[model samples]
Target: MAHASGMHSLEFKLPDLGEGLTEAEIVRWLVEVGDLVTIDQPVVEVETAKAMVEVPCPYGGVVTARFGEEGTELPVGAPLITVAVGEKQPTAGTGDTGTEGSGNVLVGYGTSEAPARRRRVRRERPVSGASATAGQTGAAGAANGRADAAAAPVDARAAGAAAAVDGQAGGPATEDGPVPVISPLVRRLARQNGLDLRELTGSGPDGLILRADVEDALRTAGRGATAAPAAEAHPRVPQTPGPALAAPGSTTAAPAEVRTPLKGIRGAVADKLARSRREIPDATCWVDADATELMRARTAMNAAGGPKISLLALLARICTAALARFPELNSTVDAEAREVVRFGQVHLGFAAQTDRGLVVPVVRDAHARDAESLTAEFARLTEAGRTGTLTPGDLTGGTFTLNNYGVFGVDGSTPIINHPEAAMLGVGRIVPKPWVHEGELAVRKVVQLSLTFDHRVCDGGVAGGFLRYVADCVEQPAVLLRTL
Candidate 1:
């Protein structure tokens, strides 16, 4: 029997995992072409909004071909893998199910449902809370029980010492017996600092090792420069900031003292931005436009119960419209393939600022959606973004991206292009400024529009015209109505 369709080849494209994602970065390939894969076996690892996730092969078969290189951001619905449909599927547990199939593209970031078969359930016995049953657990059970019973009498002293070592308590106690008593916290601290608990003197209630004792041990140990003691050599992992650079346009050469740890979405964005800048040839064009009419349109839309739309939403509508007109700007430049691949759908990604970092969630089929639909989708995406509830699907698959720096009161900025896609649009702050209309000087709401495109795929002329089209839409929002 064959898996999925009876055809010999099954094209497994990228799927929309959820949250309206349109694209994803291939983190690593777990299986290569020609390797056999089982149904629902993890084949590749990809990074989306919050975490790195493994993608499973949906069918069991030998991988015939693999699509898209690792680190390449591919559009949703693009074919990623092809499996030999009629091949005999190896039985379960053989590790022969074709997880080795190629990758595919889809609109969403997450799977709609859990795969039918993932892994077999483990049957390890559960833990019993009480040490009294330690004898039944395993070989160490008897010894554990004896230790627990023997420590009962000194439990209070040990706890007090642990507290002291943690800097919660301070005291001095005369030795009552030869048996050394210690708290778990103190033991843990000593273990972390690479100190031997046996050599430390106790200054806690009931003659325990207090914070001072631990500090003294560390100081003494540092002076000796000897190998860390057996009791305290536990390894520790601490997070630190990344490399730093000097601030821009600074006369002084003092480097930035404060550094931010690059991780999560910020880390992902930083890497992509650096790659785009290094690889893509960029050309930018700027235009100023009057947004007075656009503001009016927003007010009217709000009155019509069209979800509180922002100027950014208006700009997005314009970009989608222009992409439909100038499909070249909506295309991607495949440098390695030596071809320009155009997309059939406009999966638009909008730069949303969140507490954690900047997240770009896609609006799938942006060209097909009306203004109201886009507004609602944008609202949902932004709300999910702010609350940190966006799924992997929400953050992937974008044919074009918009970065609205204007919301922060900035005039304009040259946003780096999101790779695999040729261009990015940056919308700046809108403010009332003096304008000469016809023959008279008057105040008008104006905004700066900056378009940065990959010069390898789009020339300066195309970028400028794209900017002008967006400005025209903002200037005459009625054009958006015509598109609808």
Candidate 2:
């Protein structure tokens, strides 16, 4: 829904991209200040800790103000652009009070207008004392807020005392309006925690309720339940430090190293790995597979077909088949629920090295795709990964991962498990080796296969069984045909 179809400008802010992320680095801007943008048109590209995402503006109009430069980092709820809703010359000095924005805010961004005129909990700037301590998250946001330019004006009442949840007129229009929130996830989070949405202050643009707001309320509730320590309650404190680090005769020296900011794709990778290690009790088991038969089959198929099949596609087919027999390996451990999440469809993620860093692009419904289809899809994703255009949706939500370290000329490795996913299958270098074939000594192409999985999902017996099946398929392509 467009803002009150009059001359009103709406403020657009950076939305919280879940997983406890606070801010993002602006990679590029798609629109200029005077650019005419339509509803849901992407205005800027931002790189979060996870992936590069193009944020689309829900309200359409003339871009009045652009915030932050290309390399500047802006926190969640910080202003990004001010769009004068429903006006062509949407900037200031047009003398048009641009109001009315399309009441439709996408789930990707923030703020949606609903007719349930429920007022948001009044939130104010944090001051000194207990209120300041309670506003820890908000304080962080304020400190990190980076806006290069001032935004255009709209209804001042919308942001001041008269500001309603739905950036409408000064005071509350109806006592029955729903809370302004775009993401269902925020609603779900509040629901799970048994928190009431009607009574929380949203730290989002236009007073939109966000997950952070609900989480903060929970934190405050938890603190209220605990008695403050005696020393913290009321005690005399010294202004200087106790000097615990460098004791009387102790000497300290600085170490030399290059520092890198944990932001963007690299940061995302680090966070995921750390979480996986922390939550999942993982175990790795590996076996050497004879790829002589699978390689020959691939060669024959490529020689006879118009479209050549990739070795990766062949291995992926085997993986899907093996997973079908051992489904436990294709699941995730939900600690909160104390259950294993098993999916019917196989979303296979393959590791690919790109200019940005190492990223795993998922193949949706790998079980449904044939070798030829898998090859084409992999090729397309590889190109997308290289060009650094892979979206947040593309880089996530996989049941399992296939790591082809063979391309890197490695024999074997205990690759880290991708968080949330149960397991990862690593394919190592394939080279000619001496082996006993059908009672005779012969040279064959042997490859090492490693499977790293969450022990919480299944035991070592199941993991070994899955790896054995994969090896069987590689050694005898016809073994895979039985399941096909």
> Best by TM-score, which number?
2
Worst 10 residues of 1 by lDDT: 224-233
| CA deviation > 4 Å runs, candidate 2 | 1-8, 16-22, 33-41, 58-62, 84-256
Candidate 1 lDDT, tens digit per residue, 1-484?
1122322556576676555446666645555544445556666665554544566776655454566655455666666666554433443444343323223332222244443332111111333456324423431232232221222212222233223222233443222222243323344456545677778779876776755577677765543212211112122223343345535542223233323435446677888789988888888889999889899988887888735776566777899888887788888877788888889889999888764567788999888876678888999988777644566767777989988888898998988888767888888888999988668999999999888887777677777778888889988888776677
Alpha carbon lDDT of each predicted model: 0.62, 0.70
- Give the alpha carbon lDDT tens digit for every residue of 1-484 in model 2: 1133344566788876775668888766666654445556667777776566677776655554577876568899888987654433222223344344544443245333322212232332324565444444442343343434322122221133222222333323223234665343355456545678889878877888865687788676652212111111122232243446666554333223223455577778888889888888889999887899899999999999689999999999999999999999999888888989899999999999864568999999999999999999999998777655676677888999999998998899998999899999999999999989999999999999999999998999999999999999999999987987
TM-score of each: 0.52, 0.64
Alpha-carbon shift of residue 474 in model 1 (angstroms):
1.2
